[model samples]
Target: MKKIKTKEAVGHVLCHDITQIIKGVKKGVAFKKGHIVTEEDIPVLLSIGKENLYIWEKREGMLHENEAAKILYNICKNDYMCPSEIKEGKIELIAEKDGVLKVDIERLCKVNSLGEMMIATRHNNFPVKKGDKLAGTRIIPLVIEQEKMDKAVEVAGDKPLIKIMPFKHKKVGIVTTGSEVFYGRIKDTFGPVIREKLAEYDTEVLGQKILNDNPNEITQAIKDFINEGAELIICTGGMSVDPDDTTPSAIKNTGAKIVSYGAPVLPGAMFLLSYYKNTIPILGLPGCVMYAKRTIFDLVLPRVMADDKITLEDLASLGHGGLCLSCDVCSFPNCGFGK
Candidate 1:
């Protein structure tokens, strides 16, 4: 940094914020630090009682914050996401469509580990809307070393660190298994709960079947739904270890490869995940899902709607933050359940 006359500061980066005060009108920063001085800016500076100014001087191996911010933007941006205009050396990434936000957490951590540059994003695998702020990046100093920015770019790899996976409109099929609900001894509340959850992602329920605890009938229903073009199949209830429970066996009988018969999540420990023909996903939801406001289903539903493949390892890894607090007010997605 160096001090120079305002007249000679053209084309230089401002080293400090210039404030403008007008009673009852405005009193704030007129020009923020890191702003590039222009020929027209000299008169504004003079009017602000600036006969002399402090500005960044051109130096080797150093980049102004604005230039460094662009590097951060390029490292993280991808399709369906765009960066906002630079302001005070900061650039924010906005989602271009309603979809799930996918962030490469490992790559993002590596980039922020390098000093003088940083990137911050929303929780991964959460739903996002168009124009939502997904991430923000900036250079910490008014001037940063080009080598540090290059290192951050290197850590990001060839692909962008952040992406918005546009949600796919899937036709879902429901198979409510149990003797009570199937025989009308109890009201069927599970179907409505599942439909309301699906509505959040704009998915449609193609068809539904109420089947007793007969594995053969359950298997046939699943096959019929698949034949009718249902992209996702959800089997509710009868997933426990009881001998009478046959939902899991029925799903397996459909020739679907069972990924896992149980998950490590609370209020959803009996959750089952499988794939039909290695393509469409089949979920066996526990009874707790009908009563719990947030569960493992809420955690994994966004990825399923986004068409992101969920492997057995993905379900296993969710054990780290899979327990929902079951708060009375139920502030989820913003909670720590799936972070």
Candidate 2:
């Protein structure tokens, strides 16, 4: 990523109708920075006899065709009423490619009413600086006007709230380690269960491997996966305290830090969480991970694919609401607690 420049960089916009980009004219053209390109500017660029126009790097940051259009206007982000005056204060605004300005609530309204309204403004020729004055502040009259405004501004300051994005594109790997499972005493039911759960999210299984109960071999399998570009690793089976249960030891041998061992949740109480140095997650799921209707794996899959670093604290905190009631309805899609 390129970093935005300070005030010194000149911003330039496209000068011609290069959308079709006729041949013979070079693709990149250098122009003055901050030069607003209006709809009428297109004919002028063609008048100059230039077909293709693009921003080349300049001492001042060059403005491309898309970025230039977003500036040059005032926008309404939320529908709000201002009853008091505010000036010289900065309000965050989102600009679209068509020169529409989105007024951030910090500059337009108060926190209490932000959720209820999203109003648009049509102020053209609005001069804005990087962190410059957004708009004159105003207040909305209410029984508790001051409190309401405070809430509105606070809400405006934080436009979109952070959330645990569940179904993002992801690649998952599975490591099934257990002598009994590998030797076929138990059918490989864990693989199917894990696959079914992962399908709920936007994830693709890169691959899976089955190995005998050997911590060293399991550790090596996980390492091979990392070398092959596994983002999330799930190790199934052999999580009990038996001497044969070596998945945890093997994961530790790989130099990964265990986030939590044994959450308070049922069926999956022997689950393990660990992070490789690269922060790629390694999960040690119990035998129950294979067939439980709602194991701890079900509870944390979203957070895992969301790429969050699961901590012991996060697991400990789940004690209050982590218990899956296994409702017959299986209302998995809408429920937020498991996440």
Worst 10-residue lDDT window, candidate 1: 330-339
Model 1 lDDT at residue 320: 84
Off by over 4 Å in 1: 21-28
Which candidate wins on TM-score? 1
TM-score of 1: 0.95
Count of residue pairs whose backbone atoms collide, per candidate: 0, 27
Error of 1 at 255 (Å): 1.3
Which lDDT tens digits does candidate 1 get at residues 1-339? 799999998898888999988789998998899889999988988987999988888899999988999999999889988889999899999998998888899999988988888989998878899989999999888998888887887888999998888999999999998999988999999999999999888778987899899999999999999999999999998989999999998999998999898888997999999999999999999999999899889877888998888888888888988888889898887788977
RMSD of each: 1.6, 16.9
Model 2, global lDDT: 0.57
What lDDT does each candidate get?
A: 0.90, 0.57
Residue 186, model 1: Cα distance from true site in angstroms: 1.0
- Structural similarity to truth (TM-score) of each candidate: 0.95, 0.55
lDDT by residue (137-184, candidate 2, tens digit) is 222210122343344445445443211122347678899977777888
